[model samples]
Target: MEMLCEIHPLHEWRGLLSQLVKMAFSIFSIIGTLPIVIVFGLYFIITINSYLKTKNLSTIFFSLSFLATTLTYTVWGLRVFLLPQYDPHISNLLPYWTSAYLFASLSLIFLDFACIELSGIENKRIKQIIYSIILITYSILVAILFIGFEVEITTFMDVSDLSISNIFVYAYFILLLLFYLTLPNIVFINYIRTSILKTSLTYKKVRTIEMGLSLFTIGTILDGARFPSNIGILIARILIMIGGLIMLIGFTFKPRAKED
Candidate 1:
């Protein structure tokens, strides 16, 4: 008699597609969420650029982060539309690069912006060194996973296996969830605390970004973790959409340029 096959969660096409779509839009929603992440990222860069009269430390950090976010979102979006031609196995690599490097890069940049713009952490060298170490460690870990594995990069594993490799993949995803949940909130919380003493509209703009970040970050965690409930992914997509709208509102309040 033939043995019954075991199905893995990753192999569940409908479920996988649903989750990926949530994440894809969550990332791409930056276009809509421009107020929070894109607005703040660019606003800080430009403000710092003008204020400092040259590309100073904050400018460099925000600029690199902006580029990384753009790259990550662009690649991820393209992967979604181009999945048919490329092997499905390669799709997992998207998170490896996008979520691991790009998201982490964005987080560090957000931290730098928060520290300078909010926390008053003026030690640029310390921030740079810390961010650098983080990027390097993340890079090394990704490289190890890519190089040391016996599994083929193009081979899609059966979702049923729930094997060591699959579990490792999910484990990395959980790690990302933790980062996504903690980092933005911490930055926002600190911003809120610091703003209490400053009494400035700058903090208002920062608060807008915080709201957007909170929504997206929470959405990412819920979707990234692949919670058992079918509704988790759906909720994530809703949060992403909401976050994007909140982010777009930030541009309306930008410091208007004096008519030249």
Candidate 2:
């Protein structure tokens, strides 16, 4: 006996239409995000140019990270749309894409933290060594995640497929959440609370950085909830968008010295 597979026309049509809509949204979202990414890219480059003139290694690293993030995400979104067919090779892209943005975010945090420590800490070399160790450790972990990791992606309207390495990726983020999100925040927050300053631009910059980090943390939590809670994701996206806009505005109004 031959077994017959029956296809429901309405169900098939709905699935096709849902996929089409998702593709359209992906395209539009990428387009919308590009200008903001470019603006940040330009600011980062300009900051790096200035840093290069001054031999400031810190800013140079931060700028490079941001550039990497811009390039990686741009490629990521395009790759997904162009090759909508699910393939195992697509999973390999996760590590590089994840590392780029993670590095970028950390670089910015380092720049700010380094700046704060410059005023308070007497041993500059020690600070450098500590930061180097932290970065190296983070790099090694991301490398581990790149080879085989669990990832979840929604192909149709409500269904998602989980890749093989979910536990590892989750563990990786837990480390990141502790080191990058929690520890630095507490250190910086304490530094801000105790430090005394008289209208220094550095103080203002630190405050801005803190606010930016807070928003990113909130946004990450919201993103994590997207699968189980779409409404939460929407709220989180809005918070992140606002935070990004604020950071962009700060760059535009960055302090400049008066002509002599």
Candidate 3:
């Protein structure tokens, strides 16, 4: 017969601290994400109205992307809030994964359009190729995420024991890291190189975008590193919230057309 280890008082205190940390994090996440959801919801509505008026595909894509992103964060906040009481199951996590996948696809589509239109990429074939590549890459990433989610749900453990031995998990994370690094660099480079005559306004807009992307990248790193410590997780969530808000601010500043 296997004997259970005796629980110590110090261990109990540590556990209590962890629970307190988690509760605080969840509360912060809900509070932060609620405002984001409302703001983005309004943005999505405005984008839809603009698309209907102008018949612009970009506007429609932006609207859908924003809506998906808002939903993703909303689900995330709910998950954080419910995690303590909710029983772990694949079905419980499916909505979060699905919303995240939708957000990824829509965001990629929006980014493709923005790059082509704002960067003044005149080559239609190039634009088509870029769009195709973005779609294919996003599909592969989503597939990896699906597989990773299966592994995670099957082998559910405390965050301290969360390991990334699975190939799908590794692929998903690596691809995401590569995307965060490469896409920002590409966008900034394209903005600088392709603009015929960059003005102060355009430069400021690019700078704002760059800052937002930088914060996002930092938040991603922190989130990935958030294991074995409740404090780390709390910090990661805070950074993510701040990063998202900055990114939203950047999005509001449309890229200015190059002065002729």
Candidate 4:
């Protein structure tokens, strides 16, 4: 797929007024992503503390996954913020974006494992296998791609929007993406779906989390698919921020035991 590279470089703003406008957007975009970072950051802290108290392995995975997610947002900000000096250079942005992708993919792997445990299946071995496969496959694909493309300056601003020259590589890459994305989501959906039977708090928690995921997914698609307007990006960022807050609400919502 050809990447739409209409990057609105902040350096184009020459006058003081234009520079101030540019700063406004940059600050907003960065701030928009900050809520997600905080959400996941708190999640990481809570899970690590839970793991320490209970010694449950799944909480460790949850901690790792949330931490990875926090890293993803941090790295993702590199391209999204239209800072005057932070133009999306292939050399500079590529590494940050790729590492962000790795972190995201790794997060999904851990998320899947945590979901499995929370869902009461405990197929840890299978989750480990999936994790290893995705890690290795992505590593190999990225290496082969960089070797082939050589970081040439293309029209695309985002690395993910780069058009693949090789048919086989593209196909493999697509499959790799699905592999990274699909299973974890499936596992998580099932986990959440099954979680609400016990208590009203659980139900509220699951519903809130579901809404968060919905908002986040829509926001990502709107932004990632290149909606062709500045307003679209701004709106997407706002939606994602709301989603992050909702996710935090759900994370902190726990079911209480039935009263005697």
Candidate 5:
């Protein structure tokens, strides 16, 4: 006996839409990171030249941060293209973890820059302590993820699948939501309230960075949505890329010499 299984029209339409969304996201991801790489590459080169001439440690830090961010986006864009169609293997963990680490590092770098560059925190000891705490906390999370966690890729509503569960994964998202999303907004609001330089162009640049952070935060939240629709994911990716662009623009404006 031959059994013929007839697919429902609604299911077929949904599957087509899902595929289309995934294709769109993948294409955008590929195209979006190209400019980021070029811009950051130039930034890194210029920073290196300036550092060589002046030997400013801050300049070196800024250059390294930009380099890391550029690599993060590049790897992320590549991963979108390389994502497995089926369940991911244990071997796939390395690339996934590497991309995540790079992204998290980028966030930490920006936070450090905000504290030192924008907030004008001057106590070296205090800065060291804060940096150590952040690094150690993230390191622990990464260690746990590397050692104890297992990733499973499962399809939702016949769309492309992703890792949906894991304690360390949840912790990473919570940390990002708190630090990258919430803290930046708080910092910006505090600056607006207390800053004497609010009328200056420098302050406006800081505000632009804040806006970029807000966009990135929203995109992160959208990316984490439990909805089965792949459109949300596509939109989230686009928002993230735009946020990156805005952030880069903000970074281009150096703080006034008198302010520094």
Candidate 6:
């Protein structure tokens, strides 16, 4: 993120309508979505420790997911809203490499681990091995992301436009991201298919989890896209806000199968 010094100045939005749309995007993302994400993250961290004392470590991973998500929204807000005008303040707020992409990498790592814990795999040994492998792999990949930012290999636009200097490296990251994001979706699908609905209450509980996961996944996808207009940005921010809300709702349900 720091290496991205090249600013491709977009065309001027001199019209009142254009300015209004830009203001809407900025306001929704910064004022509306950002606070919601932060609150959701804090709720998970505090709630898990206070009341929901389940053995499942998935709770911790979910909390970390929210934290990373909060950072992502924070950095995006800074880049889009502040960096163009207040570049100096951004450096004080975050490290040079601490971009939305870096937060995304962290989120995927934790979310994948959470999914593995929630996948109903009862074998402790298998789970240990899987976790060890994931830790080692993410250590390397996250290091590379930092180095890429430091050396300017993976520069990003202020408006969240990802600029790829090395196709091979970018592809590698993309493939891993696809896998990480897909794994939870697949797990959620299986749960929806085979989850024993002993009653209407249980069925509703599972459906809520499924819906929350779906919304969060979709919002994450939209967050990464290159927005051509402010309307698109506003829509994405709104999705993120709603996604954060339902994600917490799903976590509150806490169906069985996940183990610490």
Best by TM-score: 6
Model 6 per-residue lDDT tens digits across residues 1-260: 64344332232334544654554465534654466556766755764673357656777787777777777666665555533322334333345335666777777777777666655667899778777866776777768766753223222322323345576776766676666677777766776688775344444544665576677677666655546555665566567667666756766764455422
* Candidate 2 error regions (>4 Å): 1-36, 52-55, 85-120, 149-169, 224-231, 248-260
True-structure lDDT of candidate 3: 0.58
Best by lDDT: 4
Candidate 4: regions farther than 4 A off: 1-28, 78-89, 122-129, 141-174, 188-211, 221-223, 235-251
Q: Score candidate 4 by lDDT.
A: 0.61
Better candidate number, 4 or 5, judged by lDDT = 4
User: Which 10-residue window of candidate 6 scores lowest in summed lDDT?
Assistant: 150-159
| Residue-level lDDT tens digits of model 3 in 52-89 | 88776655665776676577667666666555423356
Model 6's alpha-carbon lDDT is: 0.61
Between candidates 2 and 6, which one is better according to lDDT? Answer: 6
Once model 4 is optimally superposed onto the true structure by TM-score, how far is the C-alpha of residue 47 displaced, in angstroms? 2.9
Ranking, TM-score, top scorer first:
6, 5, 2, 3, 4, 1
Q: Local distance difference test, per candidate? A: 0.50, 0.54, 0.58, 0.61, 0.61, 0.61
Comparing 3 with 5 on TM-score, the higher-scoring candidate is 5
- Put down candidate 4 lDDT per residue, 11-73, tens digits, no spaces: 344455565555445554555567778777887888788788888866687689779888988
**Candidate 3 clash figure, as a count:** 0
Give the per-residue lDDT of model 1 (tens digit) for 1-260: 12324455446877778765654454333333343344445544554454466535544554454445444445534444444323446445544443434454454445445434443446789657655755665675566555553333431111110112465754764564465356546756776886664445556666776687678667666655545544555576467546645643542245545421
**Model 1 misplaced stretches (Cα beyond 4 Å):** 1-67, 85-118, 123-129, 148-173, 196-198, 227-234, 244-248, 255-260
Per model, how many backbone clashes are there? 7, 3, 0, 0, 0, 0
Better of 2 and 3 by lDDT: 3
For candidate 6, the clash count comes to 0
lDDT tens digits by residue: candidate 2, 1-260: 12223446667888888776665465434444455467556756776776777665545644564465455445545544554334345455455446544554564455445444533555779677767867776677657655655565543212222333477666666566456556545655766787787356655655665676578567755554443554454556556556545544433346668411
Name the lDDT of candidate 2.
Answer: 0.54
